[model samples]
Target: MWKSGAACSATRVGVATIITTVFGMALADALIKQSSTAMTLWQIYVLRSALVLPILLVMARGRMNTGRYGWIALRSLALVLMYLGIYAAIPWLELSVVAAALYTSPLFIAGLSAIVLREPITSRHWLGILIGFAGVLLIVRPAASGFKPLALVPVGAAFLYAVAAVITRAKCSDMPTRALAVWLNLSLLVTGLAASLYLSRTGVGAGFDYPFLFGAWRPMSGRDGWVIVVLACLMIGISLGLARAYQSPRPQVIATFDYSFLIFATFWGFVFFGDIPDRLTLLGMGLIMLAGVIVLTAGTPEPTRLEKAKVARDQPLVPCRVKTRTRPQRTDTSPSNR
Candidate 1:
């Protein structure tokens, strides 16, 4: 029973929020890919993390004490691994391809939930998982003569992301959102610093000229520094928009719109890096997007026995009664006797 005007207004807001979030994320990825050419991946991570910390702290203010340190650290480590895999892949793989592969996290989440949470797997969920992996194979195309093993990197990233998501749900469910954000950025900063220092000592190796991975800590160009700064701000904006979108009354509706990230990624890839997907790859991306939508819309709700019993008890009961026929019986008996 939605009012049409209100529904339309909400839909508009949701669409705008999703669009902004996806664009922000895509832009951040594009900037990272660009920055990779001039700096090490660790440098980008450290700089971006450094820039984001102040913003996160300002937003979190005094509300950053809600999360348990152990769980937060675990989740942050998972995220660091996830980002490492993804940023490494971006330099070698097309942005759209990497993004499509990363979107497989939803399927991984479903499988992980079944294993770790002992949740039941429905036929529909299984079908979605199968289709999703199939799409991944199409993108990776390991058997194909032109296959690049680097394509698997994003798949690894997706797995880590799924693991982080599972941990968040299972262990950090009560953590304030801002507190979680703070810990995540802090982890990124520490990991980045460690990696950068190690690489600085080892030096960039042959065939690893990509500044984002093996390059030494050097002065960044004015332009690239600004790009990183902008990317950092965009990350914060994207996080906020995502929070708003998912927190909306119609999460399913907003969730569906999240697939737009692939489209935005594709557009940015073309515009920024001139990276284009082949016909087969495009088909694979479409399949992945479809499978993601299916999984997202097919929510897995596990009702406990107590909840089920409560529902049953809440239902109205119908009464049944037996009618007596003593008067009719007596009349028939008297007639028979006479």
Candidate 2:
């Protein structure tokens, strides 16, 4: 009874942690979008990490996963590209649109895992894939009179993120999670420095309107600096919170609440930018969420009658594994799946 009570408590904690983490993530997205005029993408990448990387380093103990550095770099590059797509679209797309589009990542992971990992996918998983894309089409609205190209950016980002997930599973499965995060932040820092250098040297975006992407380094106001600090906090908060949440005995519960980011994104969008997703966008979000749940449960097996009989006769505990397209899987339970 005590064990069951503890499990219930742990589940509650996981649920709360995941929801809180995603809320912070959504707020970070909204903040980044709001601060676009003040801070460029590269600047935020550099400055934000400059602040948070130190603490993450202390936590990770400066481990580099040296043996798998090549694979780690590849994964980090994929994720950096994914973030670039996500943040670049923020200035142009609605927050909810970006969230929903990026949330299509589960579908991409499902498809990619089948192709790359050679994992057998269940029929329900395929149905999930189809339903997820249907949601994408509704959100993208390619045939509509007012389709925007930026709407596709998050979808592309989602695919890139899926690629990173596949790499982590196939190659970096043994790397410590915090250590991997260290490299990711380091990659972001290096990329930011390189881009800032090139832009500053060539004046490539001189007098252009894409201040968020192309603008060179500019002096930071106090408010701008604080935004950077807040964004960094959000980044670290998300990482730590996810780590804590997934550590819960009830990962299935944590996984279900993970989609709360979409709702939180929509909420922050409404509050910060007065951005409201229309009916189709909301529908797309719902389909994507439902598809994710279906995909998450796709490969879980029901115990056979013999196993059930044994359980009843002996009253023995049974163990089961649930697979997510790239979400942890049977042996891997890294939070980076999303």
Candidate 3:
């Protein structure tokens, strides 16, 4: 009874943590969208990463997994690319649209699992993937009057994010969550520094005036600086929340709540940017969320052959009895004594 109660409490904590994670991520994106108007993406990345590093370092102390450094680096690079794509698209696209597009990662994950992880892909997963892509089409509205090539940016981000997630599960599953967070932020810092150097040397073109993507570094306003600080804090919260949520014994339970990020993203979009989704956009968002929920709640993956072997090896051995001709001799002896 006590064990059951503890499990229930842990589940509740995991759910709450995941919900908070969604909100924190949405808020961070909103803050980035707001601040991007005044600062370069590289600058924001560099500053926020720099600010968040010390905190993650302290948290990750004694938790680092050096054995999986290669996988960690791969995952971090994928994450950096994901961020670069989404941040570039955010300025040109509506917040909700970018978010909905990015949320397609679950579909990508499903497909990738089949290819890379050798996980069976059920028909339901395929249906979910189709519906999810249909949602992307609705959002992108390709060849329609409202189509924008920039809409593809978030899709790219989603693909990279899916790759990162797959690597997390497949290669770095044993690594501590704090170690993953530390390496992710560190990678962001390195990417930011590299981008800043390249941009500083090349200079911004006249046609690309958006400081967030193309513009070179300049003095950040006090307001923008504060916003970056808030963004950094939000990133920390997001990292911790996601790490905890996914690391839970029953990750599917926590993952089902991840779709709420779209809701929060939509809310923040309207409140901060005064951007409202039209019927088509809303439809797309709904379909994407539904597909994500379906995919996440379908079922957990079965243990791999290696994992099954490991489980079997860890189990205690039981002694076996042998029946032999001696049993008959003992019975005969007992009968004579009687």
Candidate 4:
């Protein structure tokens, strides 16, 4: 039938979209890590977002209307926290390690969906959650010797990301994806500005460790400026790609393809940084990835486009019946699922 053919085509588009989006994201992570020694995280946040927000405004083209500014700002803050957690650990952990640890967002999403969204989570979903946590443990190896607590930072980042996704569906669902991105960049800009000011004024980072995070801004070369520009472009691309993928009729397909981020992260790590994952790390990454696939694809439904923010990027789930009202079925952007 025409419907079936159309479904398959849409699924393909979603798959391609998510794969490309995460590829750019993974590459951006590598670039940031590579540039960490040259630029502070605050500096890059200020410069990269400062460069991108104008272009995004231009692209938005006078369609900057929204009624849920408060919720949107909160969602953006959650993402900013997620961003901080992931990036702050970069100087300490390997790329693959951070990537694997951050992928734990789906498990957090699963749990949060049950608690906050009141969504239906099947037995299989619970199994996936357990497996995902096991993978996280393997990656973090808390019981092992010489363990750094920073390894758990990305795990916490995953939780923040889940909160953002939930807020997207619960409150900011009426906004546009472009607007969501613009607000996120704005928040990043504000955060960078605030952090820079505090650090400069307080002189905390003057003698403290973690120069990339809390230290004062460093001088940039022409090459460094161009690298920041490239990062901005990648951010725009990933944001738009994520929107496109999630807006496709078959968003679940898109969510499934997001797992490619693990592979891309590992590839870039090896090729660019010459960093390789040890056997346990590799196994842990595999488990985390497998858990995500299961969490996303299991107990699912045919998905549709999300509101302004799309998350839960790799899976779809159905909500349980509520006595109060009938809820329109919407897929998570990683439901609100990717």
Candidate 5:
């Protein structure tokens, strides 16, 4: 049993981690939206990435995983594109609408797991999947009159983010968290640098670039610049907290808390962007949450302790592997020996 103090600390960390993750992400999105007005999406990514890279570098010393570095780099690159897509859409999309659209990622995970993890999906799972898709359609409202061509941005982003999550779960499970964090920041840095350079050449210098990055790193600016700097730092902290949360807690539990992001997003949308979600948006969000809960609870139970021990003893834990290998080899070798 955990001591009282330890338990309290754990609870605090869990709550703080969730709150920070949600709030920081919302603020970052808002900042990117605000920055997008004055700067290109690439410039915002570069500045935000530049703000976090040095700190990640210092922390990753002695923790880097050379063997798994490639996967880490790939994951980070995917994230760069993911954020670029999400943030770029912000200038044209409602904050609540974008948040609702991205939340459809869990549905993709549920579907992808059938192929990638070989898990048996049940009938209820299908119901949840359909419900989730309906929710996305409601949020997107393509049939409505006001739909713009760029409204599909969030859908495209959701697909890429889903793929990124699957890759993180399957391929990068063993990657060191610190090393993964470092690689993410580094990859963002490279993308940001290239983007900043392009914006400079295209004569978008102040209009599409940060007013300061063109030689003068800090010029006369309003509080907005400071807000961006602070929000960028908070984004790093929240991301680190999320990495730790995923590392420590059982994934199901952490995933449940991830639902809190929707709540926080709505709250921040109102507070920062004056986005008051309509009844339809609330209903759609509720359905999406229901789908995620269904998926989480439907996960297959892990084997019992006895079954685990049996597998550890090198016994035939699953009969299919034995039959496949033994019968094939016996038929081929039996003829040769005879």
Candidate 6:
């Protein structure tokens, strides 16, 4: 009974960690949306990355190593690409639509799990995947009159983001959560620098006048600048918190917490941008959230097929056999002999 209570407590703690991560992530997105109007997304990315370095260094506190540096770099690159794709698409799509589209990551993760993790997909999981894709359609609606094809960018990002999450789950198991957190922040910093350089070279330094840079340089108000800085700090916190939480529990359990982001996204959109999601977007996002909830509750780790098959081979097929003679079977024969 005590053990049961303890397990329940641990589950509750895991749930709380997810809640914290989701809210932090949602707020980070909201800040990005606000800052996008006044600052280049590239600038925001650069500023956020620069601001996070000190925090991550403090968090790392001397545990950094040369080993696995390449993997860390790879993870960082994937994350930067994921963010860049999502941010670029937001201006072209509704905030809620983008959020819902990106959150469809669980569906991608499911497919990746089957291939990379060798996890079995039950009928329910398949159904969830179908429902999730349907949800995406409702948001993007390529069939709709004059729908923009660019809206697919976030969906593409969602796939990449799912891959990153799977990699984190697979590769970071042996590394310190703090170490991974710090490395990811550093990677983002590097990615930001690269983006800035590219922009500068193209004469699209930062602003609406720059068009694709979204202009060469739109100066930000001091207040908005501070908000961007605060948001960067929040991003660091969210990344660190998520890394630590996954270290303590299964990804399946952690994934459920993602639904919380939808709620926060809706609330923040309304509060910060006066953005209200239309009925279709709300319906789609609800389905996406439901899909994530179901996927997490299913509790299957995404593993490569090889590892799964190997594990299966090692399990006992049946209980050990014990041969014995029954005394009753010999009684009639004994009586006849007597």
| Model 2 bad stretches (over 4 Å) | 300-338
TM-score of 5: 0.78
Kindly list the per-residue Cα lDDT of model 5 for residues 1-338, writing each as its tens digit: 46777755765677667766877787777776765545555555566667777787787788774576566667777777777678767877777778777877877877777788776677777877888888877777788897676667876787777777878888887777777777776777787777667655775565533342332222315665676588678867876888876653455666667777788778777887788888887888888878877776675657678878886997656655544545544455576688
Q: Which digits, one per residue and each the tens of the lDDT, describe model 2 over residues 153-179? A: 999999999999899889987777888
Query: Tens-digit lDDT track for model 1 on 133-199?
Result: 8899988999999899999999999999999999989999777777788788888888889877777
- Record all residue pairs in model 1 with backbone atoms less than 3 Å apart, i.e. clashing: 39-211, 39-212, 40-211, 40-212, 41-212, 41-213
What is candidate 3's lDDT per residue for 96-214, written digit by digit as tens? Answer: 99999999999999999999998888777888899999999999999798689999999999999999999988998788888788888989999889888887787744367677787
TM-score (C-alpha, index-matched) for candidate 4: 0.87
**Global lDDT of model 6:** 0.76
- Sorted by TM-score (best first), the order is 3, 4, 2, 1, 6, 5
Worst 10 residues of 1 by lDDT: 203-212
Per-residue lDDT of model 6, residues 1-338, tens digit only:
99788766776777788788878887777777766667777677667778877877787887887377767777767777888888887655666777788888888988898899877887677878888888888878899996888789988898988888788777756777777777777776776667667776875544444343444345778897798788877877787677656554355666677577778878888888888887887888888888777766664546689978998999889887898977765445566687
Tell me, by TM-score, which candidate is best: 3
TM-score versus the correct structure, for each prediction = 0.85, 0.86, 0.88, 0.87, 0.78, 0.82
Write down the lDDT of every candidate, Cα atoms only: 0.84, 0.90, 0.87, 0.88, 0.71, 0.76
User: Compared with the true structure, what per-residue lDDT tens digits does model 4 show for residues 1-338?
Assistant: 99999988988878887888899999999999999999999999999999999988988766679877888888998999999999999878888999998888888888898898878787778888888888888889999997889999999999999999889989987777888888899999999999999999999886877899978899899999999999999999998998888887866567778889999999999988899888989888888888888888887543445721366654477887877877999866753333
Q: Which has the better lDDT: candidate 2, or candidate 5?
A: 2
Off by over 4 Å in 5: 1-12, 202-222, 301-338
Error of 1 at 61 (Å): 1.1
Ranking by lDDT: 2, 4, 3, 1, 6, 5
Q: How many residue pairs clash in each candidate at the backbone level?
A: 6, 0, 0, 25, 0, 15
Task: Tell me the lDDT of candidate 1.
Answer: 0.84
